[model samples]
Structures are given as C-alpha cells and as structure tokens.
Target: MQAVMKNVDCIIEVHDSRIPFSGRNSEFEYTIGGRPKILILNKADLADMSCRKQVVDKLKRDGCSRVLFSDCKHDSTNIIKKILPSIQELIHDAGRYHRAENRDYNVLVCGVPNVGKSSLTNAIRHKYLRAGKATQVGPTAGVTRSVLEKIRVCDEPLTYILDTPGVLAPNVRNVEVGMKLALCATLQDHLVGETIIADYLLYWMNRHRRFEYVEHFGLKEPTDNITELLVPIAIHSNKIQKIRTSEGRYEYKPNISQAARVVMAAFRTGKLGKFMLDDDALDSLSEPAVADNAGDARHRS
Candidate 1:
C-alpha cells in the first residue's frame, strides 16, 4: 500500500457501518500521509439508522471530518454525489505534484476485508461512468487478493479508483474488537470458528437487549448457551446431516456448523435486526484517555 501512496490523490477508507468505531487500521493515517481521506461506512442499509447521527458526530469528534454512510448494493447516487465534490475540492486545493497537471483524479479505495470495498468500487463505476462492474465482489472476506489496476469510474472528471486488498492491522487490540470484526464478516469465519463468532453475536445482542433473535429462531427465550441456540435453528432450517457413530450406525444429528451459518447469515443480511456492533465504543470516545486512542496510532509518537 505504501508503494502506491505517492500516486494516490485521495484515500477512500471503506469500513462496515455496524463497526464504525472499531476494526479500523489506524496505521493507514500515517501510511497515506496527509493526503485527503474520506471514510465510507458501507452497508449502511444493514445498520441501525436511529444512531446514524451519533455515529457521524462521534466520527467527526474522533477527527474523521469526511465520513459518508453508504449502501453499495443498491443504486444510491448519494455516495457518488458526496464523494465527487469532496475529491474535486481536495485535489483542487492540493495541486498535483508528481504527475502532469491534468483533470484526471486517482483515488485509492482501502479497508479491512469484507467491508464492501469491491462493491463500493463497482457502485462508483456504475454511477459515474454508467458502466458495468469493473471489479469482483463477494460476501466473503479477502476477495480482492492484491492491489488492482485503477478502473475508470467517471468520465467528466476522469476519476479512477484503485481497489486494494482488505489489509488488517498486524495485531488486533482486544478480543471484543476481533469478535466484532468477525461478526461483521470482515474476518473470515473459519479463522475464528463459526460457533465462537455466533456466541459473540449472542452475547452482544443480549447485552444490548436486542432479542429479535429469540423470535426469529423460535427459541423460548434468550439463552447464553450456543448449543441450545444452534439446536433449534438447525431443526427449524432442517439443516441436519447423518453421521456414522462409533458402532458403525448412521445417526441423524443437528448440523451445528450449518445452524451457526444460518444465524450469522441472518445477522449479516439484516434478517435478525440492524445493529451497531461498536455501539459501546462510541461512549468511550468521549473519555479523554480513550479518545486519544481513537485517532491514528502514530499520533502517540
């Protein structure tokens, strides 16, 4: 990412809207230098809109001056409209240094995995160029393996976006942060285990008192036990499989893995409910010591 920073006119950091305050790589602020930066909180459609203003205000307080909530899956020109003007203004203010003086603008789209970087790239391409998808997009993390060549998104301003692989911090700060990232599918599920991820989701939901999962999964009540939760989900979804026992007899068993996937899918697709996984982190931003940790990691230097 550093190799291409000199060529980048602006940095567009994409993150899951549900985790606006967590899982961000603070190192990017230093890596990208002083180039203008914008935070694209993608998957806004799957986040609780009631806390939208609080999210924006907290981001601004934490020094993210340019933040836009976006849902790249749907054709919403709001993202394009907001981003283009900011890019134009930033580029105009900071004249091109190394490149030939030209109208074309190059933007670097970056974020941790599975936060919709490719989807955002395609959305911009379709909106501005009125063209088809220029990048591959998927629900799994790390879809884009490496830094890709710039793809034209707009013709008038001659804007092109460089889509980079979802780069995570070398070390996650804590378990809660890691679990939140996993819950949002920013990290691959298998790396953290599906059951553990689901357990974290259950704990988070219960802590927030968002018990929509109870009715959604037909559970009598919210229980902390993951096995109890998955059993009913498996039965309801008929996600059962036959396995050979030690006696060499086939036995039908509830597919716990399959059931966990179902629960996660519902959360990811907003079937359960929209949530802000970083809801607790927002309050921490107001504390002086905590607020200091919210900015660029190198800020400590």
Candidate 2:
C-alpha cells in the first residue's frame, strides 16, 4: 500500500454501511495522511435508513468531512454522481506535486473485505466511461488479491482508479466487533464458525428487541439457545441430515450447520430486516468527550 501512496492524488475508502463504526481499519488513516480522502459507506440499500442523517453527522464530527452513502449494485446513485466532482474539488484545493503538469488524475480505492470496493470501482467505470467491468467482484471477501494497474473510469478529466485488495486490521477491537465483521461477510465464515456467527446475530437481535427473525424463520417465539432456535428452522426448511449411531442404526438429525448458514444469509441479504450493528456506537456519539477521546486513541494507535 505504501508503494503507491505517493502516486495517489486522492483515496477513496469503502466500508459496510451496517457496521459504520465497529470494524474499520484505522491504519489506513495514517497511510493516507494529508491526501484527500472520502468515506463511501457502501451497501446503503441494506442498512437501516432511519438514522442516516445521524450517521453522516457523526462521521463528519469524527473528521470524515466527506461521507457518502452508496449502493454499488445499482446503475446510478446520487453519491456516485457526486464522487468525480468531489475529487475534482479536492485536487484543485490540494494541487498535485509529482503530476502537476499532467492533466489526468489517479485515485486509490481501498477498504476492508466485502465492503464493495471492486463493485464501486466497476459502478464508477460504467457510469463515467460507459465501459464494462474493469475489476473482478464477488459475494465473499478478498476477491482482489493484490493491487492492480490503473483502470480508467472517466475520460473528460482522465480519471483512473487503482484497485487494491481488502486489508483488515491486524487485531479486531473485541469479540463483538469481530462477530459483526463476520456477520457482514467481511470476514470468512469458516474462520469464525457459522454457528457462532448465528449465535451472535441472535444475541444482537434479542438485545435490540428486533424479533423479525422469528417470523422470517417461521419460529413460534424467540429463543436464546442457538441449537433450539436452529432446530425449528432446520425442520421448517427441511435441512435434515442422516447420521449413523454407535449401534449401527441411522438417525435423522437437524442440519444445524445448514440452518446456521440460512440464518446468516437472511441477515446479510436483509431478509431478516435492515439493521445498523453500530447503532449503539452512533448513539454514544451524542457525548462529545467520549467520541473525541475514542477518536484520539484511534489516531494515536
């Protein structure tokens, strides 16, 4: 990442809108210091939009002056329209040094895994260049394995973007944050265990009193025990497996793993309901001193 930092005129960091505050890699802030940066909260369509303004206001207070909500799956988003203009303004304010004589601009696109970095890149390319996809995109994380050469997305201003692989922080702040990342598919599900992720989802939903999952999964009532909850879903969905017993007899059992995957898929695809996992974090932003202190600690680290 440092190798191309000097060449970048602007940096666009993409992150999951559902986890606005929990799983961001603060290391990028230090790496892209002094460079014009924009925070694109991708997958806005899947996030709870009731507190959208509050999220934007909180981000600005935390020094992210330019925050845009975007849904890269769509052909056109207002945020996509504003990106080029915003970058142009930033470049004009902070004149390029190495490429001062050059008319074209190079911007670096980066973020953690599964945050729609490549999707956003392709969306921009389609919007500006009227071109096909320039970068590969996938449902799982870490699709772009390495930084690639510049891909032109615009012609009038000759704008190109350097696509980089998703890089996560070395250490997640806490177990809850790690689970949140896993829930969003930012982290590989196998690494964290499917059942564990499902458990966290249940815990978070119950904590917030969001019982949409009960109706979505056809459960009569909510239950804290993951096994009990998953058994009903497994039966409802006919996700059953046959197992051999020690006595050489076969028995039918609930496919808990399959049921867990179903639950996780519902959460990710918003079948359960739109939610902001960082809602509690945003609420805490009301206290200025607490937010300031947390921001300072992240910068220092």
Candidate 3:
C-alpha cells in the first residue's frame, strides 16, 4: 500500500458506517503522507441515518474532514453523483502537486474488510463506464487478498481506482471494541465466536434501546440471554438438528451455531435495524484524550 500511495493522486478510505469511529486502520496516515484523503463511511443504509450529521461532524473534528456517508450496495447513485465532484474538489484544493500536469487520476480504495471498498469501486465503475463488477464482493473479511490492478472507473476525468485488501490494526483497545469490529464483520466470525458476537449485539441493542431485533425475530421481549434469543430464532427458522435418543427415538435440538449466524446475518443485512454502533464514543469527542494512551490508536484488528 505504501508503494502504491507514491503514485496515487488521492486516497478513498471506505469504512463501516455502523462503527464509523472505530476499526479504521490508523497506519494509513503515515503511509499516504499529506495526500488528499476522503473517508467514505459505506453501509449507510445499515447505520442509523438520524445520527449522520453528528458522525460526520465528529469525524471532521478528529482530523478526517472529507467524510461522506454512502450506501454503495443499496443506493449507488447518491454517492456516485457526489464522489467525483468531491474527489475533484479535494484534488484541486490540494494543488495536485507532482501530478498537476497529469490529466488522469488514480485513487486508492482501502479500508478494513467487509466495509464496501470493492462495492464502492464497482459502484463508481458502474456509474461511469456502465460496466459490471470489476472486483469480487463478499460478506466475509479479506476477500481481496492483495492490491489489484488499476481499472478505469470514469472517462471524463480519466479516473481509475486501485482496490486493495483490508488491513486491520494488530491490536484493539479493549474487548468491547473488538466485539464491535466483530459485529461489523470486519474481523472473521470464527476469530470471535458467533454466539459471543450475538451476545455483544444483544448487549449493544439493549444498551441503545434498539428493540427492532426482538420484533423482527419474533421474540416476546428483549432479553440478555443469548440462548433465550437464539432458541426461538432457531425454532422459528427451523434451524434445528435431529439427535438420536437413548431409546432410539429422535430429538430435535436447536442449532445454536446456525441460529447465532442467523442473528449476525440479520444485523449485517439491516433486518434487525439500522445502528450507529459508535454512538457512545461520540460523547468523548469533546473530552481530552487519556494521558497514558495518548498515541494509542483507536483502529481495531
């Protein structure tokens, strides 16, 4: 990524809007070195849009001024319409430096995994070239293993995008932050147990008073017990397994793993409800940083 940044005109960092204030790779600042950077908080449809302005304002105060909320998968037109103009504006404002004579633009699309980096790349290509998918899009993390060849995404400004694999910080600040990353699907599900993620999701929802999951999943009411939630979900979805009993009879057992996955998928697909998972962190925007961890990165693994 460092080598590629040398030739890149601008950097477009895509991130999960659900956890906008967390999980972004902080190393990029040193790698890109003063080049124009645009933060695209993708998955806007799955995030609580009511807090959109607050999120943008918080990010800008944290030195990320060019933040744009995007739902690349569901609504591409809105972002595609603003992306090029934003890119041009940033590029010109930054004076283009060595690339001033170069009429074409090369943008590096990067972020932690499963945050719609490829989706954004494909969205731009579709809007400009009217073409199909240029890079593979997947729900799992690390789908794009390495930096890919540049592909033209626009004709007017001769814009091209370089799709790169997601890079996560080596360590997270705490367990809850890790859970947030896991819930956002930036980290592999197995790395953090599915049920654990579901529990965290439940805790988060209950903490935020987000009860849409209960109504959507047909639960009687909100509960902290992971099993209590998954048992009903599994039974309703028929996600159960048959086990041979001692007397040769069969017993139906809820597939908790599968049920946990169902819950995770529901949140990812916006079935549970939209969320601004970092709402709590926004409160610290005005507070001074902790002394001991002054340089500690907020980015998650």
Candidate 4:
C-alpha cells in the first residue's frame, strides 16, 4: 500500500488512534522517506485520552503540522478545513511546475483496515462538492475496491481519490518475527496470563499515574501487586466465594471476562488514567519491506 503511494505527489497516511502502532505497515517509512506526508490519527473516540495526549505531545516534539484526533462518524468540518491548506499547497506547487498540457496533482490517501479511510474520504469529498457524497466502508476480513474517477475539491477538478486495501503484517517466517508482531499488536492483556500481566499493570499504575487510581478507585496501596490485591477486582466481578488452592494458596480467578471488561471500561470511563500506546511505540517498530528488496535486488544484479 505504501509503495503505491509513491506515484502520487502527496501521501496521507491514516491510522486508528486506538491502536495506531499495531496498524502501521513496517514498509511505510521506506516508501515515504520523509516525503510530503500527512498523518491522520482516526477513531480517537475509542482510544484512551491519556494515550492521545501523549501522541499529540510526541507529534509536536517531532514538528508535525497535521495531527487530528476525530471519530469518522462525527462532523469533521474543522479537520477538513485544516487539511485543505496543505492539500492546496501541494497541488499548487505541483501545478506551477507542470506544463500547460500536464497540470494535474494526485493526492493519495492510505491506511489500515477499519481505520475509517472511506468515511474520511466521503467527508472530504462532500465538503468539496457541497453535496451528500457517499462512500462505503468495507468489511474487516475482506478488501473492497472502488473507483470514483474524479472528485472536484476546492474547484480543483482533476484531483483523483484512490481507496486501497488494508495492510496487515505478513506471515512471520519464525518465532522471532511472530513474537515481535504479537508485542506490537496487542497490549499486555492483564487477563490472559492474569497472575503475570495483572502484576505488571498494578506496578505501572502505582509508579506512573498513582494519584488518579487512588482517588478514583479508592484503592489502597498494595503490599505487593495486583495478584496479591484481588479483593477489589474479585468483588467487582461478583466472585462471592474464594477457595484455597490445591497447594494451599488462596485461589481467586474472578469471572474470566470481568478483568478485561473492567480494564476496558475503566479506560473508557477515564479510570485507567490517560495513556498512549502509539507514538513512541510506533517509532520503535521495524520499518516495513526493508528485509526483502535489498537482497532480491543484489541477487538480480
């Protein structure tokens, strides 16, 4: 998907604000290589607010001009206005250099599946066309290809809008890549390996955003970590009865889904504290497509 953008004069890279890092294509950096690019962090409503703040801070530190956190379903009049100047500048510069016969600017928008690229395009096109422009969002598991030839934007009749397929991590050849991808894709699920990740979360909350948790949950400082402090979550999960383990340890496995539900709810309700899972996390991951091309080119040469 990133390679395809090279043909365009400007590339708008879209990402889900909730899990920005996970959806990033490893090959994208190599493709853009610091070209004129716009980073759109879509689906902000589903994300943790603290995470959004951290992302905004990182982008500001990096001197990025275009950064927006918006849900696709809501009105985006302001965001559209913000993007207009940049897109116009790109088109203007390209037009100035082109001969009379060749005066078209291609603006390409690309992003991962379910990141709300289609909805964004519709919103953009509607604002430009001043009509009810409609675009369909495809399914998560499948790719939907559609072409709406030329969409007039700001009276620029030749701007072409292209919607591409979602890009997912290619199959890992070994455990190394698999593990790396897993770490990139999912947060440390405090529910899966309960005794382990729960402990980590507790430690993180206490050390980093201590005040919020204490005041909000009314939680007492634990002598240990989450595994040692199951009373609160256990009660929340309605685990009325606690039994002794076969080896003589207290066993409490609250409702299987309770922990996850709680964590997600707390995150939604502003209880888990503001956190960012994308920005720096995204900068740390491997750039996509670098591992294959160099070797193939050398062999061919």
lDDT of 3 by residue, 14-112 (tens): 888888877676766888899999999888888888878878888888899889888886783387778888997888898888887889999988888
The residue pairs found clashing in candidate 1 are: none
Candidate with more favorable, higher TM-score: 1 or 4: 1
Between candidates 3 and 4, the TM-score winner:
3
Compose the digit string of candidate 1's lDDT tens values, residues 37-64: 8899989889887878888998898889
- The residue-by-residue lDDT of candidate 4 on 1-301, one tens digit each, is 5555544666677776655444456566566655566778765655566655556665666655567765666653367656656766755554533233555656667765556667677777777777565556643322435432234454564555666555443334444333222322232233134444444445545644444644444566533445435556657667545669899998755653355345444644345554444433643433345648876675465
TM-score of each: 0.90, 0.91, 0.89, 0.54
Candidate achieving the largest lDDT: 2
Name model 4 segments beyond 4 Å from true: 2-7, 16-26, 33-35, 43-77, 94-106, 112-119, 129-160, 168-203, 210-224, 227-253, 268-273, 277-301
- Better candidate by TM-score, 1 or 3: 1
Which residue pairs come into collision in candidate 2?
A: none
| Candidate 4 lDDT score at position 34 | 52
Cα lDDT listed for each candidate: 0.84, 0.86, 0.85, 0.54
**In model 3, which runs have C-alpha deviations exceeding 4 angstroms?**
168-171, 243-251, 285-301
Rank by TM-score (best first): 2, 1, 3, 4
Relative to the true structure, candidate 4 reaches a TM of 0.54
Query: Rank order by lDDT, top first?
Result: 2, 3, 1, 4
Report the candidate with higher TM-score, 1 versus 2.
2
